[model samples]
Structures are given as C-alpha cells and as structure tokens.
Target: MGRNVKSRIESESQKNNLSLIIIILLALQVILSGVVLLRIVNLEKLIGGTEASEPVPVYVEGVSEGDNPALGPEEAPITIIAFSDFQCPYCASANQLIKEIMQEYPNQIRYVHRDFPLKEIHPDAFNAALAARCAGEQGQYWEMHDALFSNQEDLSIEKLNKQAEILNLEMDQFNNCLTTRKYENKILIDLQAGKEYGVNGTPTIFVNGYHVNGADREAIINIIKDVL
Candidate 1:
C-alpha cells in the first residue's frame, strides 16, 4: 500500500513538471514574438525614410542639370545656381537653408534651381520632378515645389495629386501634363547642361556662375559675400 502511494505521488510530480515545461516554452515563444514584432516596426521606419512633393533638379539628356535657367546680367553681382536632387537628403536640407538665404538677400540675390535626379538611388526623384512639371503646366510650380519639399516623404501619384488639388490646379491638365511627359525634354535639357558644366554629383552649385564643387551653406554664403 505504501509503495502504491509513493508511485502515485511520483506520477503526479512528473505531470506537474511537464506542465511547467510547457508553460515555459509558451512564455519564451511570446517573448520572441514580441521582440520580432518590435524589430520589424523599427526596420520599416528606417527603410521608408522620407518623401517629396516637388523636386527642382532637372534631367537634361538623362544627366542632372542646374536650373539657373537664364543667367542674369554679368554685373548682376550675386548669382547662386543650386544644383539639387529631388530625393537627396542633403539637397533637401540645403534647399530649406537656401530659402532663408533667398529671404536674406531678397532683391540682391538670384537663386536658380537645377535638377539632378539620382534615380538609381532615389527611385522617386524622377516622379517628384515629373509632378512638379505637371504642376507648372497649370501655373503651380512654386506651390508644388513648396509642397513637395515640405511633404518630402510619401512621394506618390496620390500625394502629388493631392498637392495639385491643394494648389487648385486642373487635375486633367496636370494628369495630361504628366502622362504626355510635357516637360520630359525640358528635364533632359537640364541634364545635358549639367554635363556641359561637369556636374557629377548633386548638390553641385554655381555661385556667380562658378562651380562650388562642395556646396555647403557656409561655402555658398562666403561666395555670395565675395560676389556681393
């Protein structure tokens, strides 16, 4: 009778041990799942990066070009031609700073925007520029430009359309403009110009028509000061 009782107790203890093992396994699984989920969330945010509403760099002959358009009088003093990419992070920052510079100089400084979409790295750069040109067709270039740079992330047709809508552009005109690639040649022309000027990377700038190879804000300011 005593042997039977001891054997029963041992069986119960084994059952208890099995239960504890199962519980531990389940807890470990839950912990692993939580860690994986958190990591995935962080990875996604890191990958998405940023977006754009409008991009200034022009694609000339498939090369990025400065959008200085027409040069001012040789005696116009301070001229800043900023070559930028719609998808470049540094260019984006530079552009924001450029706005302040523009404001500071106001009438005295002339700042031109050049387009050099590094589509290889920035897949959406071309699309963003395309959207800007579409907006320009409806006389909303600057409006779209501000919107693109402001939104800088989430650069998609839907977002571009929203920007156009906000600027009160004719959707049909904008859509048609984008579809027909109305400004494709214009962008290509800008790219060719960049080639002529030996612009390999962006945000290569030209201050007073001189290439500011490494275009940092201070460099630009100093050049402007010299020209001024």
Candidate 2:
C-alpha cells in the first residue's frame, strides 16, 4: 500500500524469482549430466593440437628457465623449456609433438617439462603433477607424465592412481606424495619461473632463451633452427 511496502514486496518477489531460477537451473544441470559428460568427452578430443591458429606471444626469460633440468641430456644442443598444466588441452598437444621430437632427435634436443597446474580451472591438474612427481622418485616420471597426457579426459585422482599403478609405483607412496603436498614448493618454484618467462597461459614454451610465439609450434621449430 505504501512506498516502503511496495519496495519490500518487490524485493521479496525478486528474491523468490532468483531462488526459483536457481532451482530450475539446478534441475536442468541434473537433467543434462549425461550431455555434459558427452560434451566433456568431445572437448577432450579437441583439447590439444586441435587449433593451431592462435598466434602466441613471443616469450623471453632473463633468469627464468625450465623446471626440470635433469630430465634431459646435459649436453643437448637445443633445450625446449615448457610450462604446462596436466589437464590443459594445448599442453597435451605440445606434449604429443614433443614426444615426436624426442624420438626424432633422440639426444640432440632436450625437452624439459615444468609443473604449472592451473588449480582454479583444472583442479585435478595439480594432483596429476604431484602424482607424476611421486613416480619420478621411482624413476617413472615420464611414464606418469605420458599417461596423464594420454588420458587427459580423465584427470581424476582415481585415474591418476590408476596411472601410477600402471607405472609400477607403490600405491602408498604415490598417494602420500599427492596428499602430503610433497611437491608443493617445487610446483610453486616452477610457477615463479613461469612468471619470469612471462607466461600467462598453459603450454608456454621457450626455445633456447626465447618464447615460442604461437601455439601451433611452427615458431618453435624456427627458433630451434636458428639455435641449431
């Protein structure tokens, strides 16, 4: 009847409408769970190496470098230092290419993988990295890393442990390393290095001392040519 009452009524109506909409969306989400899962599956296929169109920024690192220097040959003529997330699609694509390069060079090129798991977006990525680190302690880092990338669609802890088991790592040790935050400091250090490398996204790579400017990796090959 009065202005205050009208305002209160409107506010109450608004609250009720918002609540109703939220409930409806929640129902829709429930109904579309299968569709969501299907979409996640489809997106996984397009995850890495799908779009080679985005022009990436040319990166530079004055003091920042790759995370694991010990993973490759000490005398490698070319070093590809990369900061990547376990769950990122492009990271997976870069990894697939790097695998090919490794087989191609055998010993000439060193590929260093750094843990840059983006927790907010990909919660399972950090755990995957940690699990891989655990496997690394057992001389199976590459095994775990490959498994993670190969099965990027399922980066769950259950899946990570399954991968660890396949790598022959002791289950207890793997779980402990993941839950105890064993590689927390190392991950942080790698993130700092990523920052120094001027990385603002996953799959940021540097050849020698310069950043590969594009996601497609043609720029990476060019850098390698000049250095080699």
Candidate 3:
C-alpha cells in the first residue's frame, strides 16, 4: 500500500513538472514573438526614413507663370530645375558649370532657378534671394541672377542695391520692393517647394525630372543627351 501511494505521488510530481515545463515554453515563445515584432517595427521605420531621403522624379508643377528665372527655349525637350542657395560655395561653383551646359545645349535645355536658401548656415542668402526676386520684377531677373553669383562674397543689402544699379533697375522701385518684403510670400513658396522635392542641399539639379545631386558634368551631359 505504501509503495502504491509512493508511485501515485511520483506520477503527480511528474505531471506537475510537465505542466511547469509547458508553461515555461509558452512564456518563452511569447517573449520571442514580442521581440520579433519590435524588430519589424523598427525596421519599417528605418525604411521609411531612407525612402523619404531618396530623391524622386517629379513633373514641374505649382510654379506660377514667370515666377521662376529660366533660360533657353520655352519648348526645350529637356528641363533642368535647380535648387540653390546664393551664399553656398558649392552653389557658386555649380553656377559656371550650369551656364556652360546651357551654352552647350542652348536650344535643347531649359534651365530654371528656384531659391532654396539654407538660412541656418547662410544668414545673408535669404535676403539675397529676396533681392533677386525684387530685381525680377523689373524684367532684369537674369542680370541680377548673374550679379548675385558673380559676387557671392558681398551678399549684403548694400551690395545688392549696387547690383541693382549695375543691372539698370529702377532704384526707387527695387528698394521699395526690398524694404517692404514685396515678394516674401513668393520666396517662401520657392523654399517650401524645394524642400518637398527632397532638396536637402544646395545645387540639387534635376534634368528632365531626374535628380542630380552632384556636379558630375559628364553625367549631366549624358542625361541631357538621353532626353534629346
């Protein structure tokens, strides 16, 4: 009878042990599943950030008529949209390259300039952009555009006034436009438009809607050729 009772107790102990093991396994599985789910969520966030940073091709839209400073034929097969800051040295470097490209493919390429001044790093760039827009009002946008890039070191209001004089713009009208922030809303629109197109840095060039982040002359020529 004692042996029988001992066997029954042992059997119950084994059952209890089995139940504990099963519980442990289930708990472990739940923990592992939670970990995997967390990893997947984190990975998704990482992918989202990468995609946001990548440049995507976009059609020209939202820009008003005569709002953008442009060169080349209106019906050119290729269009280059440039997001640039006046005070950025890289943008200054790219200016001559862009001009050369336009000269090379004068009829085939239409280049548009959009303001994307990084005011955090370049405090004078925003004012320079404003000055350029004010000059645009006088039908001398391209001339002021040239002067701004040529004398990038002197981007002060005084220098911009002098540039307006050189471009033969009426000082009374230009100064009033500048002082009164006549095109402040327009410039802000340009800056926001550039940001939406993933223009994180200066001189972000797009040829026929294709993103060109670097100043690779050969690559730019090839893109232009492909569109042509």
Candidate 4:
C-alpha cells in the first residue's frame, strides 16, 4: 500500500509539470505573435513612406494670373504653382530655394505663390499668411513674405505687426484686414485647391502639372530644366 501511494504521487507531479510547460509555451506563442504584428505595422508605415516619396503627375487646372502674388513672367513656358505654409521650416527653406530657382531660370518659370497653412500645427501660420496678404494690399507682398520667413522664430501678433511696420505697411489697413479676416475666404479657396491637387503636405510644387512634394530642390530644378 505504501509503494502504490508513492507511485500515484509521482504520476500527479508529472501531470502538474506537463500542465505548467504547456501554459508557458502558450504565453510565449502569444508574445511572439504580438512582436510579429508590431513589426508588420512598422514595415507597412515604411512602405507607405517609400511610395509617397515618388513624384506623381497631377492634373492642375488653373491659369497663372496676376491677382495672386507671383514672381517671374506670367507668360513663361514653365509654370510653378506652389502650395506652402508660412510657419513651416521646410516651406521657409523651399521659399528661399524657389527664389533661387527663379533667379536661375528667371525668364523660363512663372512662379505662383498660394497659401496652404497647416493651422493645426502652427497656430500663428494663418495669421502670418494673412499678414503677407495684407502687405500685398500695400504693394509689399514679397517684402512681407521675406520678413515673416526671416522672423519665423517670433510670429506673434506683435512680431507680425512689427514686420508690417518694418515693411512700411499702413498700420490701420493692415490691422483691419487681419482683424476682419478679409482674405480668409481667399486662403480657404487656396486650401481647397491644394486638397484637389492631392497635396498631403507643404512645399508641394506643381511644375507644369508634375507634382513634387517636400523640399526637393534638385527635383524642382530638374523638372523646370526639363520643361525649359
């Protein structure tokens, strides 16, 4: 009877050990599955980014006009319609880069500047854009454009007003335009246009209807040169 009892205890111990091993194996499988799922999600994001970086052709429908602030000749063979956010660092860099490109192909490119401010990220951006538009009313659009970019670090209402003052813009008129949101509708129209053109982010340049996203200076220059 003692020997039989001891053998039964040993069998039960073996069963408990087997159960613990199975539980551990199941937990490991779950952890491995989670890791694989996370890796797949990260890989998908990388693939999406890779696909986005490639340039796509966009059907841009609009005539280059004088109503908006523009540089270079309206009749130039290459038309560059740029959708930009003022407070964006990349946009600021692209602003300067575009200016250089204009200088390089002065007679060949008609550059149209449109406002596409990402107000969610840059709260002061819409106001800064309005400041530029108001300055345009005073015949100093480019002046204010340069000023805002130069002082991107300090784009408070006071700094914008200071920029206006520096540009010699009529304070009363500028203030009224900003206060009343005079160009708000126009800015909205530009944003809608950007959306129509599939502009997911700033510094989206349409070089004769070829869409180039981001601050790709070389790609922009090459596209213009190809058209020229």
Number of the top-ranking candidate, with TM-score as the measure: 4
User: Model 1, 111-214: lDDT tens per residue?
Assistant: 66767777788787777888887786666676677677778777777888788888889889888887777777767777778768788788877766656545
The estimated TM-scores of all candidates read 0.65, 0.70, 0.70, 0.72
- Model 2: number of clashes? 1
Which digits, one per residue and each the tens of the lDDT, describe model 4 over residues 1-228? Answer: 999999999999999999999999999999999999999999999999998775655556652332578878868998777788888888888888888888887688887888889989989999999989999999999889888887788899899998888877889999999889899888888888778778878878788877776767777777777776
Tens digit per residue, CA lDDT, model 3, 1-228:
999999999999999999999999999999999999999999999999898773434444443223688888899888777788899888877877888998987688787888888989999998999899899898988788878888988899999999999888899999999999888887788888877777789888777767775666776887778777
Model 2 lDDT per residue over 1-228, tens place: 699999999999999999999999999998799789989889877775477455653646473443563456879988877788999999988888877776776787877888888989998988888888888888888888888988989988888888887777888987888889898889889988777667789887777767775355667667666767
Superposed on all Cα atoms, model 4 deviates from the true structure by an RMSD in Å of 9.8
> Which structure is stronger by TM-score: 1 or 2?
2
Badly placed stretches (over 4 Å) of model 3 are 1-66
Worst 10 residues of 3 by lDDT: 57-66
lDDT of 1 at 147: 76
Number of the candidate with higher lDDT, 1 or 2: 2
Show model 4 residue runs off by greater than 4 Å: 1-67
Root-mean-square deviation of every model: 15.2, 20.3, 8.4, 9.8
Ranking by lDDT: 4, 3, 2, 1
Model 4 vs. true fold: TM: 0.72
lDDT at 128 for candidate 4? 92
Residue 154 lDDT (model 3): 84
